[model samples]
Target: MSVRGFVPGVLATAAATACAYAVAALVPALNPTSVAVLLGALVTNVGLNRPFLRLGTQLAARHFLRVAVVLLGLQLSVPQLLHLGGLGLAVVVVTVGLTFTGTRLLGRWFGVPPARSLLIATGFSICGASAVAAMEPVADGDEQDTSTAIALVTLCGSLAIVALPLLRQPLGLDAASFGSWVGASVHDIGQTVATADRVPGALTAAVVVKLTRVILLAPMVAGVALVRRHRSPDTARARIRPPVPLFVAGFLLAVAIASLNAVSPATLSVAKDVQGTLLVAALFALGTGIHLPTLLRTGGRSLALALTSWVLIAGVAYAGVRLAGL
Candidate 1:
């Protein structure tokens, strides 16, 4: 598509994202990312998403999200992950692996399609909407599948910001333990931060643990690509030649640069701001693709899968945290 074709949609998405930011600022409890998705959905369901805006929205949803994921790597530090210690690391790995595998199996049992299942599993297992976006090309899911997965993950993550903190005391978790659990269970980094921030001394652990899970995203995508290629060598070869997508490689490179402390704090801070804005905008674009009536009709099974996955992750992470004595 021509660059000009994307202008209208991109501009519309930008406007919506700005609105989302404004609303989030007014409502301190709300996340801009969540607000962006809602605004996009509202516009689409209300029939305001015009034909001329489609191309730009599509571009924003796909390319902009990928770029945001790349910038996300700057927030990770290798040494910080190492500081999680052996048992803490084990908790993260086991929780992610089990949640991912179990969610996929649950999707199959629910008769959900493979692509949507994979996207859901990825989103719930790794890092929410960003993970869903990253896995889209590898899974060969359509826009609907991507939007559904993003929606489910976003909802559950938002709920976590409230529910988990309330459970912290009942669960008998201290600040550090709560942080570990939040990091393990929450889908989005922002949600994790929100939940963990409710308890003093929890944010650092939550962020570090969440970033560790984010680190696993690249390998997970590559593994899925390899499995797909193995199952259908010819078709997969034609479509997905690289096991690791270029954007994923960029993510890794960004992580390495961050680890090396190559970028100055000022630059990193600016990159972080840009990353957040891009992600919010991309989510708004993705939201535009959601048809509320259609989503309501098809959401039953996906909602069940999402809820089940949410409980599974929380339970497993709780057990892991307790076992690890975090």
Candidate 2:
């Protein structure tokens, strides 16, 4: 597409992203990405999205999302995962792997399509909306499937911010243990921090554990790409697409740079801000593709899968944490 074709949609998305940030600031519990999706959906459902905006919005949702995913690597560090200790690391792995595989199985049983199932599993098991965005291309999912998965994960993550804290005492977990639980179970980084922040001294462990899960994103995405390539009927198309997407490689490179401790704290902070802004804009674009009526008609099984996946992850993480004695 021409640069001129992208201008309108990009501008529209940018304006919506800024509005989302403002709204999130006003409502601390609501994540900016979630608000962005809602804003995009509202615009589309209300007929505010014009033809001129279509190309640009599509660009934001696809290319811009990849850029944001690459930048997300700056937030991770190998040392941080190491700090989680062997048992804590094991907890993260078990939680993510089982939740991902279990969700896919549940989706199949529920008669959900493979693409939607993969997207939902990625969102729930990895890092919520961002993970969904990263996996969409590899999963070969349509916009509706992508939006549905995002909505499901975002809704569940928001609920975790409220529900997990209330369960801490009942689960007999102290602040740190609760933090570990929140990290292992919560879908998004912001939601994990929000949940753990309810208890003093929980934020640190929560952030570390969450990053460890984030670190798995690259491998998981690569694995999916390889599997998709292997199963394709068209060998020519399979050969044309790399087994690992370029953006995934960029993400790994960013992680390596961060791990080397070469980037200044100020630089990393600025990159984080940039990443968040891009993600907000990208999600808004994707949200524009959502038609609420259609989603409502087709989403029942997906919703059941999401809820079951949520419970499964939380239960598995809890068991792993207890067994590991984290």
Candidate 3:
């Protein structure tokens, strides 16, 4: 695409993201990504998306999203990672593994296609829409599949923000336990943080546990790449894709730099702000690509899969919390 074509769409996405952030500031319960996505979808469905804008929007969704993810690593450090300890780490691993594996099995049982199923599994288990986008290329999924997965994950994450807090008293969970549960179960980092913020003393544990899951995003993507290559060596030979994408490697590098404590806290804070803004823009781009009618037509099976995955993660995380005595 020419510079003229690209800049307009990117600018439009940035404007939409700004609007999303403005809304989020007033309505704290509404995530910036969610708001961005909704606005993008609303604009496109209303026929406002033009040719030049479309190219930039696609670029935002594809490239900016990865950059945002890479910046996510600056949010963590080694001591914090170790702070989770053996028990916490074990719980995170088990929860992610089961959610990823179980979602796929359930998808197959429901007769969903493999590529869509894999994207859904990755989105639900790893990190919602970001994970779906990261895995889409590897899974060979279409735009429809990616959009559907993002929608399902976003819906479930939204529900968790409300439902989990309501269950806190009935579930007999202390702030730490509740935070851990939210971190484990919620699909997105923002939603997890929002849920945990409802309780006193929950924020620390929640961030730690959630970051643990975020760190796993790299390895999970690599693992999928390995599995795909193993399954079809001929195809692998014909077209070789790296097990770890460059952004993921950058994520790891950022984590390492942050762990070293060489970067100042102020710098890290700026990075976080930038990351969040990029994510908002990327999500807006992804949202613009979604066709609501098309999603509705094929949403039934995907909805079922999302609900089942939500239950699985919630149940498993609850059990992990109990077993850990958190």
Candidate 4:
């Protein structure tokens, strides 16, 4: 918390994020947030850690990511919300709930620890690393588990960037259906945009559906916090905080303002840019905390959960699209 401790972590995060942006510029297909995470991991694994940067990196990963997620709400508006309507919203709710439940059960079957598995389930089923970061305190999970869940989400999301496009043609999906599938299934907004942008008519549907899933993030986090509190012993009950997180409140406010169309287009664009930048920096901070050896110890089980979840979501999304007649 001291200046000396904080400055180093900020500098490390900033540097890693800078490198991630550069990489993204060169390889536009790669998600900048995921690239930042990988770069952060690379820096740490390669022994580039400075002692002073530790606390700052932790702050960046925890606090900064929440801020970014709030900014993310600016990208949504009433029009996009209406596009999905009742059916689209229902599909998002169903898919997210099923994926979350399935992943947790699968994680148990794989013998992964409860907290870590919960984090993984939230991360994979919801908004990827941001969701994982948000759920960390609520779940009272280990940093190692947070990093591992993020890494697995990143890995699977990255794979989808490549694999989804290939399957697009083979699966004979039209533009709208393909977009809906990607929006429903992909972990992060950046990854969703990148995947659906490949096909015409897909981008709009993808963004709409993806943001619908994002809208559910608040309740999901609140539900987790509530569960954790109820499950805690009566002696410790007094220590439990409110179920709704502050940043999630900010997220809802942003969405409400955005829906009102109060913000100018130029201002919204700037917020979007800021959101992306903050997320990259946060992911880099998170990456620096990772230990490859520790991650690998549970990697197989985590990977299995991720792969199974990926398949499940993809299939579910496809079914949703077909059922909706999109």
Candidate 5:
């Protein structure tokens, strides 16, 4: 429980994420940065760790990816938030609140195990794998639960990648507004761009709103962790502090990098590409590594929760988008 000896996992997470980045850079087909990262990370989860690397893999993934996300913020433009201003802030508050509450309440009602329920909720509400990683420790999500959360996020997020952009094309919405809609509704930042590109100006708005939402992680995690601690204070002698999750910090860093334009668009794009690959592999790992017996034992509950969460999320996301006139 001390987790003092878990250093190896940390190392592995970095190595895996890095390996993903390298692969993305090398692959010409993958232009978007998140795609590569998603693919590479997924590959690492399935191929690299299988039969040999599993020992510290999850630890590495859980711990190191946060730092990577911090490093990722090489792209954020703070001034943009000012440009979008009130609308951006509103989007963040509304989307996050809806997703978190819907998933939590619905999942609980459906009887999903607590960890799986939280994983589904957070992934749906925030930036997929990264958000799940950030929430994992606070919720005490074990390996399987973490994988499940990441898997669902990746699967759903990937679909959004292809669907959102195309979906917006027919809406007759302008670019900026489309971007905001995508960012507000879609799971990943990359997906937001793809979805918004079908329109004008929306891409930028989406990113701005998404980044602003990202900034709220500090408060959200801390508050959730605090509430969790109070709810289960008996067994836990000490409270779990869900400070700003490191990957979220890294994700912010990635945003900064993009914002400053310090890192070339090519480089940022490549990093995102790797992120995509990583996501694919993570999904595979999630599927393959599942403990069938355990899932069978708890799956009925999880399914119920997942369905309820989805209903709540869909209802809220739709309402919020409509309320914003998107």
Candidate 6:
């Protein structure tokens, strides 16, 4: 039986999601990514407070997030990623590579226990909030590590929302390029939107590229799960096999649906909206999975490594985008 009972996060996710939609309708100027992340975590936390509730809410939450991720993809096309062409592909490679490099080196440097570094690294570098959600079950990350990663991504993305506008002004870049850079760099979809809003005329490109990165996250998480297994000594004796992360599969299937020519734009848009709502809820559930004291047990080294990974991603985003002329 799950001991932790969810209350606050669920309350937070529902209220926040409502707030996101209301502002979108009334003020017509709000972006919902980070808020969704927060609310998702909150709502799911409450769902998990009881076994029956957790089971139902958890499944529903995942289904929603997956659809959201796919719907978000409808904003892009194969050609755009191809347009950035080889250089565009490089952006993803570098972002992912740097993230992994930082995680491994820092993890070792800080003595960050074992699995924590890998999980946080994937979350921060590849897809942000979604990546962490996908990686948790596969990597078997303890509840606390997952929570810490969520908190870190959310905090960083929030800071970007405020800082990105000023950044665009100083950079002296045009819309498409800026969008590409932001898409290539930011941690989550909301940050991409928030960053786009601040930059002027950057939404379409940024959101699309960000979706490109999001689609790539599943493979990275799956790989991490395998590596973790290879390194585990007990695999030989205990015959443990890693569990396939269901959300990752769902995320892929959603992508397939989005890629189909048969799906109408209106239908895709609806799917995205609904999924965005649910993904946020799933995150709420993942947040519910978090236990405060358990997170604190991370070997002191892990925190330092995680911090370094985040710092590197943020810094690289700015410089890499500029260098790429995005």
Clashing pairs in 1: none
lDDT of each: 0.91, 0.91, 0.86, 0.85, 0.60, 0.64
Give candidate 6 misplaced runs (Cα > 4 Å).
Answer: 1-33, 36-77, 229-244, 289-307
Ordered by lDDT, highest first, the candidates read: 1, 2, 3, 4, 6, 5
Worst 10 residues of 3 by lDDT: 236-245
TM agreement with the true structure for every prediction: 0.97, 0.97, 0.96, 0.95, 0.70, 0.77
RMSD of each: 1.2, 1.3, 1.4, 1.6, 5.7, 4.8
Clashes of each: 0, 0, 0, 1, 75, 18
| lDDT (Cα, tens digit) per residue for candidate 3, span 1-326 | 36887889888998998899999999999888788878878987898887768889989988998998889889977787689998998999999999999999999998887899999999888788778877877788887787778878888898888899999999999999999998888988888888899888888888889888888888898888878877887874426677667788888899999989988989999999998899889988988877888878877888899899999999999999999986
lDDT, model 4, position 260: 91
Error of 5 at 16 (Å): 8.1
Query: Would you give me the overall lDDT of model 1?
Result: 0.91
**Candidate 3 TM-score to native:** 0.96
For residues 15-74, could you state the per-residue lDDT of candidate 6 as single tens digits? 556765665566434445555545544544455355544554455445545555545545
- Model 5 TM-score? 0.70
- lDDT (10s digit) by residue, model 1, range 1-326: 57899899989988998999999899877888899888889999999999999999999999999999999999987997789989988999999999999999999999888999999999999999989988998888789999999988989999898899999999999998899899988998878887898889999889888999899998899898888877887783546478778899899999999999999999999999999999999999999888989898888899999999999999999999998898
Give the Å shift of residue 217 in candidate 4.
Answer: 0.4
lDDT of 4 at 183: 91
- The TM-score between candidate 2 and the true structure equals 0.97
lDDT of 1 at 37: 87
lDDT of 5 by residue, 1-326 (tens): 44544555435545544554566468532323344345434454455545344544554454345554554355456666677667556766787888887888877677667887887888778766666766776777677787666655555655565665675556555565566666766665655555555556676667776766665655576677777777877654334343545555556665666667777778777776665545433433343345546556766666555545544544555456656765
Ranking by TM-score: 1, 2, 3, 4, 6, 5
lDDT of 4: 0.85
- The true-versus-predicted C-alpha distance at residue 119 of model 5, in Å, is 1.7
Q: Write the per-residue lDDT of candidate 2 for residues 109-169, one digit (tens) a residue.
A: 9999999999999999999988997888788878899989988898899889889888988
